[model samples]
Target: MTYPKRFAALPEYAFPRLRSLLDHHDPGGDVVHMTIGEPKHAFPSWVGDVLAENTAGFANYPPNDGSPELLGAISDWIKRRYDVGLDLNQIMALNGTREGLFNAAVALCPEETARGERPVVLIPNPFYQVYAVATATVGAEAVFVPATAETGHLPDFASLPPQILNRAEICYMCSPANPQGAVADRDYWAKLIALAEKYDFRIFADECYSEIYRDTPPPGALEVAQEGGADPERVVLFNSLSKRSNLPGLRSGFVAGGPETIRHIRQLRAYAGAPLPLPLQRVAEKVWADEAHVEENRALYREKYKVADEVFAGIDGYMPPDAGFFLWLPVEDGEAAALKLWTETGVRVLPGAYLSRDTDRGNPGKQYIRVAMVAPKQEMRDGLTRLRDCIYA
Candidate 1:
């Protein structure tokens, strides 16, 4: 069988490999799962009621581009959050940002962007799985850029050689970055936007975790791009209701960018993508337009951050995240530390090595573990205390 060569070389999914490593072992104490970044906060009380009101719409087919009402809600949210206005034509409803992140490559990344060479898709070393998969799906060369402690936990794309940048077709960035929780500031976004403009590539900002953070909201990629006056099409920002409203099951997100880029993405979605159902879109509309619930949710995460700080204070190399809800703690070997945490303290965390791949220098995540702060405040504190004592102590 002539299977596709692109995926044949890819590593197995991270979670399945993790399950194989630990599923057979019995936890030594009561289990505390600090692995996946699934938020456990309360969703808006009106979600169910809103869905019920639009239940009849479910029988009808959904528009691929999303209804005008939903689009308006998304646009309004962007305007309020980032102080940037976007036309409805420049936004497309996604079943989830996951869909937009993966599909944008297929729709926007060309077979050969620089003359006659296979274009390169730049990804952070410890990037969302979707980025690498998207690059592979489009038959582009995937270049892993080191985003480690050395680089303040963000990828430095501007440092790449001009040849690679010239062939670059896409760059994936995550703000309030997953696992590390390092938020990219305006300078970072401006620099990246300039690079994208210089190379004629697009930037895919995976900002699903943008809302769950400490202190001020992270600078948005689209807003920074606009401020830098780069070509609007050079940046496509993907955001979702999952983290914002604690509604992962709702599976609602949107892609906003230049009209031409969005038009191409919407055209591709028409043939291969499933839009959010009418009822779900109705709920998404309200969710995006409301900020009170989001503010309350941020306060909850803030409390968790304080808990982590108090628990891990005085420990060596314990960096409180600038934003987001994960702790990428340094250790000698991520896998060994995770197994020890599970066996001794019954606190399960993801080995950082599982989230990253080896590169020319080394796997940047070879000596860390990713602990998600997604439990209730008390439970989260217990988990962090156990983790600190079991590992760092």
Candidate 2:
């Protein structure tokens, strides 16, 4: 049997790689997991009630794009959050942004650029894993750009050579970036939008971690595009209820862009997508409409941010995240630090190298470990303290 060769070069996924690295070793102390980004905070109290009320709807097929009510709710939320008014046609519900992120590439990325070359997809190094996979699945060249400290932890698409830029079809950007937690600002969005416009590529802005910030909401790509008067289809923004409402299992997210962009995405989803169950869609509708729960969730993460700051204080190269929950702590070697921390201190964190690709200079994540601060306050504090003592001491 033969398999597609596109995925041949892909490395093992981050978590499984982590398991292979440490599972056989006996932990020296009580185990405290700070690995995956799953939120442990409470989801909205009303979710159960809403699901119960809508359970009957599950007997019927769900709308592939999204129920009218759910789409309207998402549109209203976008208006409230980004100050950008969107027609319902501009939004398509996603099982999760991960699904939409992958499918959007399949639907939007052209097989060949105007120059008649296999289009390139620009991905930030130390990126969300799905971005590279999506590019590969679509038969595009996946160009990994560095998002290291020198670039302020965001990919500099403008710095690419004109030849590469000319063949670009899609650029994936995660604000409140996954491992590094760096938030892209308004200027960054504007510049990226300008570059996308110049190169005729679409920007896939993964704003999944947008709401888990300290102070001041991060600027959004859609809003920035509107402000700059760029083409409506130039930016496709993906957001979710996972981080916002502490409902990762809800698997509810949405992709918003211009009508044509969404039309293409929704058409693809109609045939090949797994629409959210109607009951879950009802739950998402209610969740998107309510901000009280989201605000409460953000408060919990804010407290965790403070705890992390105090724990890592005075430590050189410890850059406090602009927003989002992960702490990208500097280390001599990520794999070694993670293994040692697990075996010696029983604190499990992800090796940063697992999240990034190697370049000529080096893997940017080689000298770091990603610690997710998603456990209960005391548990998280304990884990961080143990990690600090075991490694930094």
Candidate 3:
């Protein structure tokens, strides 16, 4: 059994561990799940019709990268959103950004740095688990950079010692960060791109939650990289229709970068990737081209944001998210708080420690619980109110 040892140090996935901790106990009241980030909003009304119209295409093999029409729609969306024009060669479709995020690392991260050291991948401490898994898959050293409140909830790669940065091959960043819901601004993106350029590393920008904002749109990584006049290949952008269009089940996303970067990624995808089914591709083509439904989705989230604010009002240390839908709320101990909430109030949440690993500075997420704001506004309001009365009151 000479299996790979890279995942040996990795903790079990978050949700299963949450179940082991809470499932045996009987819930004290009616159960209300506010754990996973799956959206409950209605997807576009015409999605079924579109899928039906294209069902015949399912009999044929899908285009490996993306159908030209789907890719064109993605490119057009990017142009409108980021003001950056991209050639079709610079983008490829993804089943979901999860695979894209992992595969991009395998396709882009080097076996060793220029100085002959094992490559280092910089990951925000409380990161999407796939980032660490991808780093491990590629045999790179994972450097967990704390993206706590003091760091504006974003990893500060520039502060790491030059020795660490010198061996860095990839840096993973998520705007509208998953648990914390922090958006990286233009200055943040510019500085991060500059650091990648200085250290000769590439930035893997996960912008999946980019569209669900309250105010202005977040500055995109690719746009910031272009605005800063850095090498176009210095940043790779990964985005999806999941959060943006309430289409998580659609499993449509895209990876875009310079020609060389995409060439390598698409080449790997040809052999190992499962292209989006032609019917699904046709559905996505029309979905990406339409923003009316996306605007409606954002409006719904805005209402939920207001509900959360009113429910948690006047609570000390309550920092409303800049964008995205999760609330990383403070607690004395995340696991204890989550269990108590579940057993006493029947409200489910994820323990922050499950999303983070212990480090010399401590497990950054140990003192919080992540509450997803993805349920319908009224249910979310009910959940938040119960959570507030149970914990804060």
Give the per-residue Cα lDDT of candidate 3 at 267: 89
Model 3 lDDT tens row, 20-54: 99999999688889999999999999999999998
State the weakest 10-residue window (summed lDDT) of model 3: 374-383
Model 1 over residues 159-204: C-alpha lDDT tens digits? 9999999999898999979878899999889888888887788898
How big is the positional error of residue 103 in model 1, measured in Å on the Cα after superposition?
0.2
Candidate 1: clashing pairs of residues: none
Score each candidate by Cα lDDT.
0.90, 0.94, 0.93
| Model 2 pairs in collision | none
lDDT of 2 at 80: 97
**RMSD in angstroms, candidate 2?**
0.7
Per-residue lDDT, model 3, residue 148, is 94
- Judged by lDDT relative to the true structure, which candidate is superior, 1 or 3? 3
